[model samples]
Target: MLPDADAVSRAAADLIGSAVRAGATTLGVATGSSPLGTYAELGRRVAAGGLSLAGCDAYLLDEYVGLGADHPQAYRCVIRRELVRRTDLGDGHVHGPHGDADDLDAEARRFEEEVRRARIGVQVLGIGSNGHLGFNEPGSPLDSLTRVVELTERTRADNARFFDRPEDVPRRVLTQGLGTILRAERLVLLALGERKADALAAALTGPVNPDCPASVLQCHPDVHVLADPGAARGLLDSPRRR
Candidate 1:
């Protein structure tokens, strides 16, 4: 039952279109290689005669602490290059954690409030090979909200692809916790490639545990996991999709 990347992107576009039609003003997004295709497709739709993000408000999922907002690999910069700058969404509507904030906790609280007020209509997520969601590594509580977190070695390694050198990746990050992400009315979790198969299967069938933080999605009211055949190998073999 696993879908290819194109299927996932089309499904995401359909969700975005529905939200636009319903007058949704805000969207929560994740930044990573897994989401690149969806963003690209969305950008294409805007480029063609499909949809526009003119009045949309976008909230990013996480930001590495200590990285300058303008840092090329920073989530802000990535979002700008990949999605925001390419869309009609006004510059003022794009929101992400302030990595330079003097009071990190206060900043996290403010972000939580903004999300609450915006009432995000759709949230896009990328799964870590270790099953984390938005930097909420294993053991993160399902009810957690925005907070500062120490990046796990595995996560840092996985994210190193975006940095000039592996060591350049940040050791810490500020992320909207599982609770914050689940607040969105709809959620789309995208995964691709064989590298993600084990984690995806664990999330879909294994017991919900902090070790596999993304497993919390099982409790979400409206969550759709979209994975390519390579990533869905085990799940397809399971009795569920059958």
Candidate 2:
């Protein structure tokens, strides 16, 4: 486990940089607090001429449904502000499911086709305190594909911090499901803070079940987990409480 969040971010960045240098063309990126440091490090590397993501195609892991284009909390807007604007990846190279679509099911199909065409090389993820990856909350099917899902109250509550009020958070989302995310050549799951400790432990060592959706990563051939001490406490048997 890493000493702190910064170290975990650097480790994740180093791996991503190596992947890019080795000619990985597609990247799947995650939003939220977990990946902020990693994206910042990537932006710094680009600014220093040490790295470039110019031609890399970026796919967002998920998006909230019904948010307007100008909504600050919209996943697409968040991605542009947090990563794309800070790096060499052009806006055209970044894609996310159309959460505002008139027909959500058709949008999900279109997103699946787009991702299938691009073939994601590496996917970055964050384990929810409820053991979710992307928006695949508890009880999501193991073989689920890109689809729209009702947001669990727990998931909505956790995300409330990003909005002005708890009720302002969207009630549904379009997310790359367990099956779709598993198609990536590699997975990097990042977790930080004591709040994520229990989930991280379940994802790393518990049964590969839909109840703890992230646990399915155990079956993946190439999965990298980067967590700070606080988040790793459960696995390490530390005295830190979650």
Candidate 3:
């Protein structure tokens, strides 16, 4: 069943709380509007009750290739502005691919190794309008791991909001592939808005296809989808929700 975004955030916070209590050391996180509420609520928890993140390790899902680390819309900057700076997670705990690195391949491999060593306890994801998960666009191999990807025309258009002009958007990205994301013991996906309703229905009720990469989550044992009422408009009529 589709859940409201706030309910999803609360559930994610509860899971994070449980993980902290259980001594989980690593977390996989994603960017975009869908996770904004989750991060906000988590920040509140840190403020109100002292949810310690000092010992936790964090791995971000993706990053644009040419954007500077300080770019306001860069994933690194977004993480810092949203969750990292708001909480007590130390400087070294938050990890993401080096967007400005000279060696992109080496950076990708390093990220993959970090994930291998950390063994993420939970992964938070936000589905793309085109059904991508972490820049793993249509036809990405189900078992693929970390890699550099050329953003599709649709993806570039969707992300143009972060750039001054459509031409300013980067054409390529580095992201954890489907296999890398699925390696997390638990996965939480957040979707919202009417524009996302069709994609949500396709992902939850339609056949699993490379064309709709998010649909693959249906096969995972521990995947939870969180969508607001607008995003769940079609889902409300689905048999599973009823």
Candidate that scores best on TM-score: 2
* Sort by lDDT, top down from the best: 2, 1, 3
Q: Tens digits of per-residue lDDT for model 2 on 100-210?
A: 999999999999989988899899999999999999999999989999999999989999999999999999999998999999999999999999999988877777889
TM-score of 2: 0.97
Tell me the lDDT of model 1 at 211: 81
Relative to the unseen true structure, what is the C-alpha lDDT of residue 4 in candidate 1, on a scale of 0 to 100? 77
Query: Rank by TM-score, descending?
Result: 2, 1, 3
Q: Residue 121 of model 2: what lDDT? A: 89
Can you give the TM-score per candidate against the true fold? 0.95, 0.97, 0.92
Of candidate 1, the 10-residue stretch with the lowest lDDT total is 233-242
Off by over 4 Å in 2: 238-242
Model 1 error, position 219 (Å) = 0.8
Off by over 4 Å in 3: 1-4, 238-242
Candidate 3 differs from the real structure by a C-alpha RMSD in angstroms, to one decimal, of 2.3
On TM-score, who's better, 2 or 3? 2
Each prediction's whole-model lDDT (CA): 0.86, 0.92, 0.84
Write down the lDDT that model 2 would get: 0.92
* Model 1: pairs clashing at backbone N, Cα or C within 3 Å: 139-210
